[model samples]
Target: MIRKIIHIDMDAFYASVEQLDFPELKGKPIAVGGGGDRGVVAAASYEARKFGVRSAMSGVLARKNCPELIFVKPRFQRYKEISQQIRTIFYEYTDYVEPLSLDEAFLDVTQNKMGNPSATLIAEEIRNKIWNQTQLTASAGISINKFLAKIASDFNKPNGQKTIKPAEILPFLESLEIKKFFGIGKKTADKMYHLGIFTGSDLKSKSQDFLEKHFGRSGLDYYHIVRGIHNSPVRPNRTIKSIGTERTFEENLSSEIFILEKLEYIVEDLSFRLKKQNVAGKTITLKIKYSDFVQQTRSHTVPYYLSDKELLLDIARNLLFQSKLKESVRLIGVSVSNLNSDQKKKPIAVQLRFDF
Candidate 1:
C-alpha cells in the first residue's frame, strides 16, 4: 500500500521562542546561546541566519558574522513545555507520531482520527492549527513515505507546505542533488561526486553491489531511497540510545592535567542528564579532538550499569591516560552508550484505510 506520511518541522524553534516571549527581539538578529567568547550558538533566528549565523557556531564567530546579533541564554525547560503543547496537538490527529527532535516530527496519517482522505489537506489543517494555538509557524511535507516527506518539508520552508503526489516522486528524486538526500552528509556527497554521482539520476545508474562496496551497509538504503522506497515507520515511542555531553575549549591544552580537569566537568553534566532520564549505561566513551582537527575515541564497558559522577569521572580519567595525546587537544567529551533504555521494541505498523 502507498502510505501517507507527513513531516512537520518548526521554523527556528529556539530562536522563534525567544522572539515570541520578548517582543523587542522580533525582527532583530538574535542568537539563543551564550554571548561569551567560549560559548556556542544553540540556535540562530532567521534574521541572524541572513548574516550567515547558524547553530553550533562559536559565539565569537557568530558575533563576527552579525555584529548586531543579540545573544540570549537558552531556557530548555520553557522549550520543553512548548514542545509538549505542540506534541499534544499532534496526538489529536494520529497516534503514529515520531519526533526527530523537540522541533520536528513525522506522522503517519494514512489512517487518521479525523478520517481524512487527503494527506495534503490534513497537513494544511495541522499547520494552521499550530499557528492559531501557539502563534508559531510550521512547515510540512506530505508524500507517500517518510523519506520523501522529509525532503519535501525543506523545499518550501519557514511557513509553507508541499505535497509530492505519486506522479511526481520519480521525477523529483531524479532531479534532486545528492547533498539534498536526507541521510547523505557533505563528506558522503563529496565522495559521491568523485565517483560521478552528483544527482539522484546519477546515483540510480549505479548497481546495489557497486554502492555497497563503497558505502557499506548504507548503500542499500541509498539505492532504495532514490527510487522512493523507504519503509521505515513513524514509531511514536522511540527509545533513547545514549545520553552524554561534550565541550569545545576556547584554547587548546597540551597537558593531561587540563584535559582531566575538563573531563570532570563533563562527567558532572553527563551524570545530571542520566539521572534526569532515569537511565544508566555500562559503556563509557571518551572523545578527543586535537587542535589539528583529528578525532579519536576510547571506550570501556563495565559489567554493570553506572551513572554516578565519581565513577564516570574515574572511567573518563582512565580513558584519557590510556592513550598519549596526539597533539594539543581542543575538545574533550564523555558519553554513555549501551543504555538500559536501549531495549529493542517492535515498530507499530500502520493499518492503512486507503491506498494512494
Candidate 2:
C-alpha cells in the first residue's frame, strides 16, 4: 500500500516563537536561551543561522560568534502552548500524528478526516493555514512512507514543500547520500564510510542477511529503506518522555517536611502525566542538592513501570532516606524513567518493588 505521510518541521521553533512574541526582535538574529557562561542555547532564529549559532551550543560560545547576539530565556510553558495549538491543526487532517518534538511531527493522511487522498495538497494547505494563523513558516515533505517523507521535508526547508512519488522512490533514494537516510546519525555515517556504503545504491548492493549481520536490527531497517520498501506506519500512539519536577527552597532545609512537600508535588505531577501518556515506569529516582553546592541522585529500577502515584512516591521517598547527605538540602527533585507502554499487556505487569 502507498502510504501518504507528511513530515512538518517548524522553522527554529523556540526562537521563532520568541521572535513572534516580541516584535522588536523581528528580522534580527536571536537565540532563545541564557547568555551566561554555563548556559546553553535552546533555540536559534533563522537570522542566527547566518552566524552559525545553533540550538544546544554553549550560550557563551554563541555570544563570542555574534557579539550582538540577543539571548532570551527559554519559555517552556509558552512553547508547550504553541505545540498544542499546532497539534490541533494536525488532528484536523489525521489522527496518525507522531510528534517528534515541539516543532516537528509526522502525519499519516493516506485516509484522512478531510477525505483528502493527496498528501501533497494536505501538506501545502496545512502550511498555508499555519502561516495564516501563527505567522510562523513550516516546511513539509510528502511521500509514500515515513522515512522518505521525513527526508523530503528537509529538502525544502522554512516555508517550502517537497514530494517523493512512489514511482520515483528507488532512483531518488539511490541517488541520495547515505547521510541523508533516516537513522544514520553522524557516528553511523562515519561507520558506513569505512564500509564503502556511501549512498543508497551501495546499501542496496548488500543482501538483507549481510546488512543484518553488520548492522544488527537497525541494519534490517536500512536494508528495507534502500530497497524503497519501508513499511513502518505512522502510529498515533506517542511515547511520553521522562517525568520530573524540581523545587528551589526559600532557605536551605535540614528538616524532612520541606523535602516531602516538594516530593509530593513532583509525584502528583508525574502521576498525572503518566496516566495521560498511558505508560508506567519501573525505576524511581530522587534528586537532592545540598546547601554547600553539592548534588546527588539515587535511583532504583524494577521489573516494570509502576502506574500508581502512591507507589512511585513511596519508592522515591525511600530512596531519599537511603542517601547520606553531608549537608542540608537546598533543592529536591523526583523522577521516573525507563517507561514501557506495553506494561498492561506484559505478563505479571512487571511489578517492581524497591527495598528501602
Candidate 3:
C-alpha cells in the first residue's frame, strides 16, 4: 500500500525562536551562534540568508558577507522546550512522528486518529497549530514516501506547504535536479555532473550496475530512489546509539600540540552534550581526516560509562598518537557509543498510538 508521509521543517528554527522572543530583531539579519573567528553559524534568518549567510558557514565568513548581521548565542534549552511543545501537537494527530532533529520531523499519517484522508490538509493544520502555539512558522512537504516528502517540504519554505500527489510523483522526480535528492551531497552531485547525470531522468537512465560501479553501495540506493522507490519507513522511537562532535579546521595542522589542543575542545563539547542528555557510554571513538581527505577511526571500549572530559582527552590522545600520522590532519572528531539508556529522563521514541 502507498504510505502518506509528511516532512515538517521549521524555517530557520533557532533564529526564528530568537526573533519570536525578541520582537525588535524580527526584520533584521540575525544568526544564531558565536560571532567569533572559530565559531560556526547554527542557523541564519531569512534576512541573513538573503545576504548569502547560512548555517555551518564560519562566523568569520558570515560577518564578512553581512557586516550588519546580528549573531545571538544559541539557547538550546529554550529550543528543546519549544520542540517538546511542538511534538506534543504532533502526537495529537498521530504517534507515527519521527523527529530528525529539534527543527524537523517525519509524520506517517496514512491511517491517522482523525481519519483525515488528505495529508495536505493535515500539514496545513499542523503548520497553523505550530504558528499559533509558538508564534513561529514551519514549512511542510507531503508525498507518498519519506524521500519525496522531505524534498517537497523545501519547495515552498518559510510557512508554506507543498504536496506531491501520486500521479505527479514520477514527473516531479524526472524533472528534479540530482543535487536536490535527499541523500545526494554536494561532492556526489559534482561527480554525477561530471558523469553526465545532471537530473533524476539522467540518473534513471543509468543501469543499476553502472551506478554501483561508480558509487559502490550507495549507487544502488540512488538507482531505486530516482525511480521513486524509497521504502524507508518513518520509524518512530528511534534510539540514540551514540553522541559525538567533529570539527574541520580552516588549515591543516601537522603539529601534534595543535592537534591535541583541538582535541581538548572537541572532548569538552562532547562531555557537555552527554551531561545535558544525561547519557554516557563505554566506547570512545576518535575520528581523524587527513589533509587529502583520507579518514581513519580508532575506538577504545572500556568497562565503565565514560563522561569525564579529562579522561576522554587522555584516551583520545592515545588513539591519535597510536596511529602514525600519514599526513597533516584537516579534521578531528570524538564520539561515544554503547550508551547507558537507563539514565535518560524520558524515552527516545514518540509516544505510540494506534488507530483501531
Ranking by TM-score: 3, 1, 2
Please provide TM-scores, in order, for all candidate models, with all chains considered together: 0.81, 0.70, 0.85
Q: Which residue pairs collide, candidate 1?
A: none
Report the lDDT tens digits of candidate 1 across residue range 184-295: 9877999999999999999999999999999999999999999999888778778878888988887999987777767776786677567545679999999999999999
- lDDT (tens digit, per residue) of candidate 3 on 1-356: 58888999999988999999999999999998767866667689999999999876778899999999999987878888999999999998988888877889999998888989888999999999999999999999998888999999999987899999888988999999999999898879999999999999999999999999999999999998888898877777666789999988889999998998788768867875675455789999999999998999999999999887788888999999986999999999999999997545443433232321
Candidate 2 per-residue lDDT, tens place, 209-261, comes to 98888889998898888877776676665555467766667788887876776
- Colliding residue pairs in candidate 2: 281-305, 281-306, 282-305
